[model samples]
Target chain A: MTDAPAPGRGWVAVVGLGPGDPRYLTPSAAAILAEAEDLIGYFPYVARVPERPGLVRHASDNRVEVERAAHALALAAAGRRVAVVSGGDPGVFAMAAALFEALEAGDPAWRRLTITVEPGITAMLAAAARVGAPLGGDFCAISLSDNLKPWEVVTARLEAVLRAGLVVALYNPISRARPWQLGAALRLAAEHRGSETPVVLARAVGRDDESVRVLPLAEAADAPADMATLVIIGAESTRLIPREGATPYVYTPRSVEAAR
Target chain B: MTDAPAPGRGWVAVVGLGPGDPRYLTPSAAAILAEAEDLIGYFPYVARVPERPGLVRHASDNRVEVERAAHALALAAAGRRVAVVSGGDPGVFAMAAALFEALEAGDPAWRRLTITVEPGITAMLAAAARVGAPLGGDFCAISLSDNLKPWEVVTARLEAVLRAGLVVALYNPISRARPWQLGAALRLAAEHRGSETPVVLARAVGRDDESVRVLPLAEAADAPADMATLVIIGAESTRLIPREGATPYVYTPRSVEAAR
Candidate 1:
C-alpha cells in the first residue's frame, strides 16, 4: 500500500462524485466525504453533495475567478481536510487543472500541502456503459462550450475525430447559446461517419427520468439534447444489441466490420 | 432497485470476480455469492471465489468436455442458486457466452430461471485506470487469442482499430503456445499508431505485485508480456498529462483535430 503522507498539512482530495447516483459512489469516496471538514465546488455540484454536520460547504458561480480557486487551496492550507468535488470524475475535464493553476502561482504556503485526485466514474464511461459499449474503438470527446477556447479550435478537433474514424463523445454539446453548435457538430459527423452510425443520447444517466435513446447520427442531432446529455457516436462496427427486457445496449465487435 | 427474482426454479448469476482483488468486488455481487448454493466455474476462477457453508463448488478443466457446461446448467435447473464465476468481468470474454450456450440446449424447464450478469471491474478498465485514462474515449477490447477464430480475423480487427484510431484494450495478448502473436500485434500497431503512441502494460492488474509499465507502443510490443497482462493502445488524441508529484497519466483530448 502506498503510505499516506504525514498528516496535518491540509490536503485536498479531488473526488469524482460518480454519475449522479449515491449507490454508484465508491465506498472510499463516501468515506472521504464523510470525514472531510469542508467541500468546495460549483454550486450545482455542491448541492448534489450530501449534507453532513461540521462540513463547511463552499459553492461558486459556474465560472469564477482564480481567487476562488485560491480560496480552496487556502482552506486546505489552513489545515482542514477539503474535497474539491466535481460531478463526474474530477481528473477528466474537472478541478485538477484549476487546482494546479492555483498552486502554480508559486505560493510558498500552498506548496507545502499535499493534493491528490481520487478517480470517479467519468460521464463518458457512465454514458457508454448505459448505452451498451458504443465507446468501442477509437473515440474522441469534444465539448461544445467555446467558453474556454476559440470556436475555430473546437471545429478543428471535430474534423480530426472524423478523419481518424474516432467515435465522438460530445460533452457540453448544447447549452443555452450553443444550440447551433450541436447542429453543426452533427453536420461534421455526417461527413465521415455514416448518417446511419448509431448515436446514443444518455440524459441524466443513473438518475430519475434517465433516458438512453439510440438512433442513427442523423436523428440524434435533431433530438432534444441539452447540457446534461452525453452523446456517443459509434463507429461503423458498433451494433444495437436488443436485450429481452432491458434497454438496448450498443456493442462494437472485436472486429471493425462487426461494428457495421 | 431491481427486485431479486425468486430462487425456486433455479437462477444463474454470471459474476465477475474482478482482477484478483477481493476489495474490488461490488457489494451486490458479494451479497449474491453469500446466498448462492453452488458455484460453477473454471478451476482457477472457482479457487478464487470465497468459501462459505452450504455452497458447493464445481470446477472444470479448461479443455473439459462440452457436457460440463450442460451439467452446470442442469444443476442450476434443479433449484440450486448458482453463480458461474469468471475472472475479471464475467460478461467480457468469460462465462456468459458459455453459460448461454449450455442453457440453449437445456430442457425448457431451465428457461424459468433468471440469468443476471453482475458486472465486475474488468481487467481493461482496471488496467486502463491504473495507467491514466487510456480508455478516455472510443475504444475496443479485442482478445488476441486466436484459439477460437483464425489469426486473419484478429489481424483484421487490429487494422480496424488502427485505421479508426480507437484506443484498443488487448486481452489474452500472449500465451505459452502463441508468444509471438503479441509481437505480431505490436508490429501491426507500429504501422498504424504513431511510434510514440502510448501503450500501457498492466500485468496482473489489481493483484498483489501488480506492475504497470507505461511506454511507447513500439517499446511495449516486444516487452515481456504474458497472458496475465492487459495491454492498452492509445488513440491518436491520447497524451501524457503530468500532475504534481505523481506519475504521468494518459489522457485523450476531448477534441481532436480530426473531429473538428
Candidate 2:
C-alpha cells in the first residue's frame, strides 16, 4: 500500500455522488471518498456521506458553489485530500465547473495540486435507464432553470434542439423559484414536434420515492415534475411500446429512417 | 438472498463497459455480469470480460448489431441470463437501441422476459472529466457516423447545435471507413463558431492509451481522432486556463452571461 502524501502535495477530487443511491456509485468514486480527508458540497449532498473520524464535511447552502469550490481548493493546496461531491456527474451542471473556475482565477500555486474528476451516473442516464432508453439516439441536455442563464438562451436552445429532431433531456425543469419554465418549454417543443410525441418524467430516480410517467407531448406540461424531476422529450422516431401487464417502454431507435 | 428464477424465466441486461476501463464500471454492472450465464457483444467488447465456468461468450462482427442483439434476445427467451455489453453507455449510440429494436420486432412473448439497463460511465462524460468540465453547461451528443442515418441529418444536427451555442460532443468522429466525416463536421462548425473557440479531443479515455488535447476550433480538424476519440467543441463561454508546468485545464462556465 502507498503511504500518505507528503505535506504540500495534497490532491482534490471532484466526484459525482450519483442520484442519492449508494449502489449507483462507481467503485472509483467510493474509493476516492474513503480516502478523502475533507468533503465539501451543498448541504444535502455533503450529508449523504456518512460521518467518519478523519473526514471533515464542509456543508453549505445551495447557490454557493463558488465559495465551496474555493474552500476545497484551499484545503487541497494546503496538502489535504479533498473531495467535492455533486449529486450527479460533476461535469454536468455540477461542481466540476466551479472547481475549474476557482482554479483559473486563484493563485498560480493552486494549480500545483493534483486534481482528478470521477464520473458518476448522471441523473439523465439513470432516468433513461429506468424508462427504457428514451435517449437511445442523438440527444441534448438543457437545464431549464434561469438561475444561471437568461431565459432567452434556454428558449433558443430548446427550439434549435427540437427543430433538429434530437431527443431532449430537461434538468431542473421545474423548481419552486421557476414554476412556469416547464410549461413554456413544453409549448416550445409542441411547436416543432407533434402532439403525439412521447415525454418521460422520471423523478427521484434510483431512490425510494422514484416515480416514472410517460405521456404525449400534448399532456407533458401537466406532468408532476419538480426540482428532483428529469423530463425527457422523445425524438420524432421515438416509440412507446406497450407490454402485456407492464408499463409501456419508451425508446428512440438507432436508425432515423422513421424520422421526418 | 433471492433464488435464481426457474427455466423460461431468464432475463437480459444491456450493460455499458465504460470507455475501456474496468474501474469505470459500476458496482451494479459488475454484479450483473457476475450473475450472467451468457455474455454477448462485439468481438473486442466481449473479450474485455474474463472467462469462467458455466458462462458462455458470444462474440460477433462489429456491424451486425441487429443480428447480435437478436441472438441475445433469443438466448434470454430460452431461459438464459444474458448480458449484452457495449463500450460506452449502452443507451448512447450503443447496444441499448439495438436491443430495443430487436424487442420491438421480435416475438411478443419476448417482452415478458425481464430486461434491465445498467448505465456505465459514457465516453463523453469520461472525456469531459479528463479535460476538466467543458460540458458543464448545456451540451449535445451526436454520433458523426452516417451508417444509421443520412449524412444530411448529421450535418443539420451539427449546425443546429452550433447555432444554439451549446457544447457539442461528437462520438464516432472518425474511422478508417469514414475518414472525411470529421473534416466535414469541422468545416460546418467553423461556419458557426469563432476560430478561437476551444475544441477538446479525448482518445481512449480511462485507459492507458488515453490522451486529451485542447486546441482552438480552427486547428481542430488536424487533431488525431479515430473511432475511439470523442471531440468536444466548446461553447462561447468555454475557457482554457494554462498552468505553469502542465497542460491547460478547459471548462465551460455554469453561467451563460458569456455565451453568444
Candidate 3:
C-alpha cells in the first residue's frame, strides 16, 4: 500500500482542565497542550494554565464561546493543532457543545478537522470524591443557565430527574445574576426526596480554600454557594459517617449491616 | 506557618491509575509517580506502571489491602514520602476505601499519618465521560461485589438509589461467577425509569478496544455487559444524539431547551 499522506493535518483536542487545580489535568491533556501551538478558552480558565514557550494563548470572555470555537476551528484549518480548553469536563456545560455548534454552522473547511474532547476530572466528580461516594446510582447533571433555555424547561427536567430518583449534580446552579434558580431547584428536589437526603456542598475543590460540608437537602438551599461550588445531592441510602479527627462526610448506601 | 514541613517529607500523595491504560493516568498522577521513591499498590495495578528507576515498587494481592495500607502507613509514619497507588480513582472503590477502613480500625499509633488520596479518573467517570455524559444529573455509584458486603444490602441500596430517580453508575456490576445481578439491577431500574431512559455499557474505558454502547433501560438486561463494563443508567431527560462520523452518544438534559 502507498504511504499515508500525513493523515489529514487539521486536528483539535478539546481538553478539560478539571475544577480549580492544576493537578487534576489529565496526562493526555498535558501532552496535547505541550504539542499544540495555540490554545483557546475562557479568560479565567485560560489564566489557570502556566506560561509555556511557543504556546499562543487566546483567552475569550465567558459569553464568547461561539467566537472561541470559531477561532479554534480557524487555527485547526491552518494545519495547527489547536486546543479549546475548558475548566471542567469539556463535554459537560463547557466548550464542546459550543465548539460543535460553531463548527457545524461555520466554514466548510473545518469539517475535515479531527476534533477530540479530552476528558478532565470535572468539578462534580472532584466534589463527589472529596465528600464521599454519593454519585452511586442513577444521576443526571443539569445546568441552571436559562440564557439559552427557558426556566420552565429547566424546572421540568429538574423535576423529572428528582421525581425519578436520580441523584443530581447541578452545574451553573447559581450565578451572580441567577441566584433564585438554585432555591427553585432545591424546592423541586425536596418535593421528591426527603428533606434529609444528604446534600454535599463543595466549594473550590482541589484548591487552597477548599471547603466541604455535608448537610441535608433543605439546608443546602440556604448555604453560601457560588460559581465555584458544585452541589451533590445524595440518594435515600446516604449516611453521615463520622470519622475521628476528620470532618464528617456523607456516604451513600452505607454498609453498616454488611460490615457487622 | 511552620514552613509547611519543607515541601517533601511526611507528604504522601497516593494516586489512582484508572482502569488499565497509561493514557488514563492523569497528569497529577504522573507527577506523583515521578516524585515517589517508594510506590505501593496491588500486584496487577503495579505492573501497569511504566518502567522507571529511582522508584521502589510494593505489590500486594487482593487479600492484602490492609497490609498494603499498613505498610504505606508505616512508611509515612516514619516520615518517608510514599505513593500508595490503586486502580481507578483512589477514593472510589480502591485504596482510599481500604486506607480509610484500616485507619478507622488500626491502632491509634498510626492515626497521625497524614495521608492524602489524590483522585484519579475512576473507571466509572472515565466510562461516563466516554459515553455522552450520562452522569449529568444526580447519579449513584454501586459495586456489585458481594465479597465485602452482602448481596441483599447491595440490592437494597440499588433499589433505594433507583427510587430516588438518580442516574446509576454500576461498579463490579458483574463478574465471571456473578452475572445475573446486573440483569436484576436493570430490571429494578426499569421499574422506576421509563423504558426509553438511556443505559450506557462501557467496557475497558480509556484502553485499547474500549467499547461503548447506548441502549434503553428496558434492553439493558440483555446488553453485552461483563465485569469490565461500567453500566450507567441515564436519567429521564437523557437523549441519544446520533451523528454521522461520530458514534451515538447519550446527552442528558438534551441541550438548553431541556436544560431550562
Highest-scoring model, DockQ: 2
Clashes counted in candidate 3 amount to 33
Candidate 2 or 3, higher lDDT?
2
lDDT value, residue A210 of candidate 1: 85
Global lDDT of model 3: 0.72
Docking class of 1: incorrect
Model 1 agreement with the true structure over A1-260: per-residue lDDT tens digits: 22232346578776667677765455556777877778888887788887776788998876663556688788777777888887766645666555655665647667667666555556776676554445544355566777665677666666655654556778878888777888888888888888888888889876787888888887877899888888887766666655566665565543333222
Which digits, one per residue and each the tens of the lDDT, describe model 2 over residues B7-113?
57789999988888787888888899999989999988999998888788999888898788888888888888999999978998899888888999988888888
> Which of 1 and 2 is ahead in TM-score?
2
> Per-residue lDDT for A202-239 in model 2, tens only?
99998889998889999999877899999999998899
Best candidate (score: TM-score): 2
The per-prediction i-RMS, to one decimal, reads 6.0, 1.6, 5.3
The two-chain DockQ for each candidate, comma-separated, is 0.15, 0.74, 0.25
Ranking by TM-score: 2, 3, 1
Alpha carbon deviation, residue A191, candidate 3 (Å)? 8.5
Per-candidate TM-scores read: 0.71, 0.96, 0.75
| lDDT per residue as tens, model 3, A127-163 | 8777655654435566777877678767766766664
